[model samples]
Target chain A: MLFSFLNKSVHLHGFFETDIYSDMQKPFYVKILLVATLLLGFNAFAQETDNSSAEENGSVKAEIKEFIAHHLLDSHDFTLYTIDEENNEHFGFPLPVILWDNGLKVFSSSKFDHGQAVAEVDGEHYALYHGKIVKTDAQGTINYDEEGHATNVKPLDFSITKNVVFIIVVSLLMIFMFSRMAKTYKGNMIPKGIGRALEPIILYIRDDIAIPNIGEKHYKKYMGYLLTVFFFIWIINLLGLSPLGVNVTNNIAVTFCLAMFTFFITAFTANKNYWKHIFWMPGVPVFMKIVLAPIELLGTLIKPFSLMIRLYANITAGHLILMSILGMMFIFKSWLGSSMSFVLASALSFLELLVAALQAYIFTMLSALYFGMAVEEPEDH
Target chain B: MEKLIEQFSFGLFFWQLLLLIILLVVLRKVAWKPILNAIDERESGIKNALEAAENAKKEMQNVTADSERLLQEARMERDSMIKEAREMKEKIVADAKELAQVEADNMISQAKTAIEGEKKAAVADIKNQVATLSLEIAEKVIKEKFSEEGKQLKLVEEMVSDIKLN
Candidate 1:
């Protein structure tokens, strides 16, 4: 029943999916309320099951919190769905764990037994503790430092985690879609299939975002990176919203890497005027230049820093709030309260969908803006 | 902060960076290059087609105006030609009439002079004939008068008196 509900929601591309789900001519308000109530009910159920083993005082809330945190983290296995929580049965496939401890130590994530067992590989015992692979004894004992931090030697992990899988999938999907779109160009000027839907978006990035932000002369140079980043984040964000539990952009590591790309590109491609304005303010008072130079320099670093934090925080907060709202249904336990929470959660989900695209657009737009500033030709007044 | 720091995996960052670079490179070669080129080509194609259409429209207008001007010029030329022909015909007719009047006047004057000369000659010839007849008659009368001296003397006296009275 739960799987079917999730499947129906997954197939819902937009809000106009009432006719597909039901034959009855329900009013729009009732649909909204029904969707909200359903979301609340699902959240309550998820909370109940996830917190079943840890049913201590106020355990549902704590479980929901843990669930949100777990959702935020990158995992070794891609858990598609939970079959039986008590029995620890998850209906998904394990990913390959690639680690470099002294030398290469490759193994399947299933060897860790969902982080409950220690795996002995080539006479070396290792355990999964808090989503990190650590060196442990036969008993899988994890030593802690005075600060309660793990003191166990961590292997240099390069595992194909859940997020990595999604990354690979999304990238490959992008290549397939665009290659097919490009192939259609050989036949006629008008695009078809995925190209038809994606062409306008590409043009929007080119005309509205890239060309406007990055001037036409220099826009084409940055189109590859801009287009890639835009669609990458957009698609990743959209996937994150799905029940598939692929919250990639929410990962600080991922966002940090993305921001660094923009930063490095700006730093590398910046013209002389950009540095002049940063390090030594041109067309300014000498005293003011000394004061403003440091600020300007700091601004350059802060720009990408903010870019990283903005995307990470927005996506993470979105997930947190959504999970929390859904979790609220469990605490409410009443029809009215559960329904309200569900409605709020449902509305937020729609908002999140808008945000998914909006964040991508903003990131691309800002990156182009930074590139524009970097390569801007100084005006002669 | 400690947990956050612990959660920060250099491995994840490295992998993300590496994968992103790979994605960027691969996508640039595969997706972006072609899609952008196609879009630009289509845009320029549309622009060129529109410009051609605009030029064709303007050319059509120009051709229409040119044909209209040609028609007007032909009409004007035809009108001038017809006017010139009419003027030439009228001038020729007037010149022929003037020449005919001068020739007719000359012939009439010549005929009048000839008539005057013929009348004078006829009158002179009749007077001469009359004079001859009168002389002949005079001779006969003289002869008869001589036979009859009294009648002759009376005719001579009458002639003498007629002459003295003239």
Candidate 2:
């Protein structure tokens, strides 16, 4: 009878263990792992298929060409692969839109797309395909709508991208908050309410970032840029967390634009002292100075380039790693393994959030430091 | 080369340039200006508030000093008034004592003069009475002696001579 009881208990334990495993399978981590494993399985399947297709064609190059033709630029179903959707259309081609008096009047993508749309109010010729507002007589000039109504001015066929919208909203929010803070200061009020919360951060930037990096006299000169950068990068990084998938910082082009702006500002704002330090070292040996000139000048250019690449690579790598981890879930056939992969991926995703903000702060801080360096006076020593 | 040149037209670049210019202009006018102005205004406000606080502190100090000065003056005035009262009482008491002394002196002098006049009158009366008595005595003795002594005529003549000499 004792032996039978022990056997019964062992059976019950087995059942309980199976139940626990089944319950654990439905967690978010499990889902992520499952999705990742599936993706990997699909990738393997595709690779096998590609090999078979290549064998049939007698060339791997032919298989690759076929794959590109079918996947990349195909116009079937009137669809385009775009990173962002705008104006109810995908951004497949580089296009320009005319914005005048805060009104979008015309948009155009490529010639094959919607070629142009004439303004219904005044019959003004608007090239919707290229986002250009044109007068009938002038090549690029815009003619006003005949109707006095402003809303009739339709946005060019193109719509604002998610990234652009995010940027604009964040910029407006920053402006509003800072303006309110200014009012609080004017009223001689202690930083109460939202102002109180932001006051410490602003002070930190001034005391910790601007003062230490830029030096006292020239810090004020770069304050505008520094504040702008800090807010801009922070806002973009935050938006990256949203479901909208705004990867502005990850986009090399966007980083390039930001880096370029900093470069131009530094280049234009550099005092003679900045250049003197680079081109001619006062205390260095003559031979060394000659050798250092080219390197120092090159460093100046490389500084901004590295800033761009650093921001882009870090953000892109974070996203890619997250996606890859998630993809591993589908690649694994075992439910346990997939679940574990998902848990790891989720943890990494949480870490990515912190990294995003940290990256923005680092970028802004470094940029401010560079600006400070560019404008700093040579030390007396 | 010609086809590639045709493909890559200047128009697209021109459009990009125009967009960039517009972006810069719009951003400068709308975004940068307001942001910078807000920052400047905030700084000025903070500075002004600090100055106002300093002014208020100085004003408070002045008011405290004024109150202290007024209190000191009041204390000094109270001390002086007390001193003046004490001095007045002393002077009045001195005057009263002096007037009493003068009245006593006048009464004493009047009594002494009356006493002197009365003594003089009494002395004159006493002298007159003494003279009368002496005369009476002399007359009686002469009458008695003359009746008894005819033989004493010569002595009477000598006595008359002595009386005239006395």
Candidate 3:
């Protein structure tokens, strides 16, 4: 509903050719929004009655902030939701925990009891505190220093956590899909089944993204990396938006790793002219080269740094805004105020879907652009 | 802020790096290489087919034009042959008529000369017959007169007495 105008303009450009909103009429939109408003109004009124016994409003607001922070963090177990809020009983499965302490130690994450209990393996004690596995005493006591940092001896964690499981799942899904699509090409030119849907997107990346940004001569070598990163980020972002509550790209550590790959690939594959341009630019005054060298060198590192933060902040901020607006439903006591928030939240969800695809495109485009620069041939004047 | 920073774990970063590397290597080998090659081959195939079709169309047009030229030449040849045949027939008919007229004139002149000769012969024969008959009659009369010669002497004496009296 919010992006109807944007869809119209994109349709006019003849890029997509099929506008998803072209068949929808205005009355149908009004009917859907109206029904949503009525449903949200009733739900909010009921919640207002339940929360009437609360002592202060400030405490509730603080709790909401803490809840958002916890939602953004990665965890040792895959907690789908809390069934009993008072008892703190969670409904989800536990993943396998691996650690590198004195030797190899492997155990199920259920031994920690959702971070309330410590796991004992071969006479060694370990506890998951703040989503970090640390060595502790038998009583699961964590000793903190003056700065509230855990002073306990920490072991290297190689556990298969929630995020790791999704990564594996998504990777396997991609391999299965594309390999099947590739198999259809053994005898026929056109792809079959799901490949029919995926062929155009793959072609788009090849024709529009890779060939244009990375020149034809060098684009073939980098095609594997470009395709892998584009689909990986795009699929991961879509999974984050699902109700499964898996936000892998929102983690700074994950984004840092992704950016590191792009940085290393560009650095390793750069030609002689690429480095020359940085240190000693051609057709410039001698003193100007000395002054510009340091800045150009720093620019290389800063490019990937920005890439890392851009993906991380964009996803994290989107999650923050959407959650906060939904949280407003509880704070607003009247039906009118709560219903308005519900409508805003619903509209923002559609926009987030577009941002998910856009972020993937931007990351891949910039990466290809950098690779183009690194391998560019020096032309004669 | 302190707790948020604390949530950044090195283990997660390590795991992510390992998984991504594995993914890139596997996908590059199994998926991208073959798919790209197939698409490229298909595109070139389409281009070749279009060129072949265009060449065939040009050949068809050339064949039609050749047939049309041959048909026009045959029609012109047929028209001139019919004209020559008509002229030959007219000359043969006129020659036959002139020969028949010359033959008729020769026969008529020959028949007229033969008729004239026969008429002259018939006239001469009639003249000879008439002359013979006249001569026979005169001779008979002269025979009769000589028989009367004795009386002629007596008469001569009478003629002499008449001459003496004058």
Best by lDDT: 1
Q: For residues A112-201, write the lDDT of model 2, one tens digit per residue.
A: 243333333234444331222233322323445576322223332233333444445666676666666655655454655676776666
| Candidate scoring better on DockQ of 1 and 3 | 3
Over A259-363, each residue of candidate 3 has an lDDT whose tens digit, in order, gives: 899999999999999899889987789998997788677777766766776787678777777776676666554486567778988887787788888888888
Clashes of each: 0, 23, 0
Interface RMSD of each: 9.0, 14.5, 9.6
Chain B TM, per prediction: 0.60, 0.53, 0.50
What ranking of all candidate models by DockQ puts the best one first? 3, 1, 2
The lowest-lDDT stretch of 10 consecutive residues in candidate 2 chain A is A69-78
Q: A365 in model 2: Cα distance from truth in Å?
A: 1.7
Task: Give candidate 2's whole-model lDDT.
Answer: 0.59
**Candidate 1, residues A1-381: lDDT per residue as tens digits?**
223333433443232233311222134225535655666654566457666533542577566656766777899998987788788898999999998987898999999878888999888899998788999999999999897888999889999999989988888888888888888888588988988899889888888998877787888889999999999999999999998968999877888899999999999999998898888878889998998877777678777766776787678768877876787677656677678878989999999999999999889998998999899888722
Index of the highest-DockQ prediction: 3
User: DockQ for each candidate?
Assistant: 0.26, 0.01, 0.28
What tens digits encode model 2's per-residue C-alpha lDDT throughout B1-166? 2211222212323332333344445444554445446555777889999999999999999999999999999999999999999999999999999998999899999889989999998998998888888788887877766776674787878878789753
Model 3 lDDT, residue B99, Cα: 89
What candidate 3 keeps of the native contacts, as a fraction, is 0.66
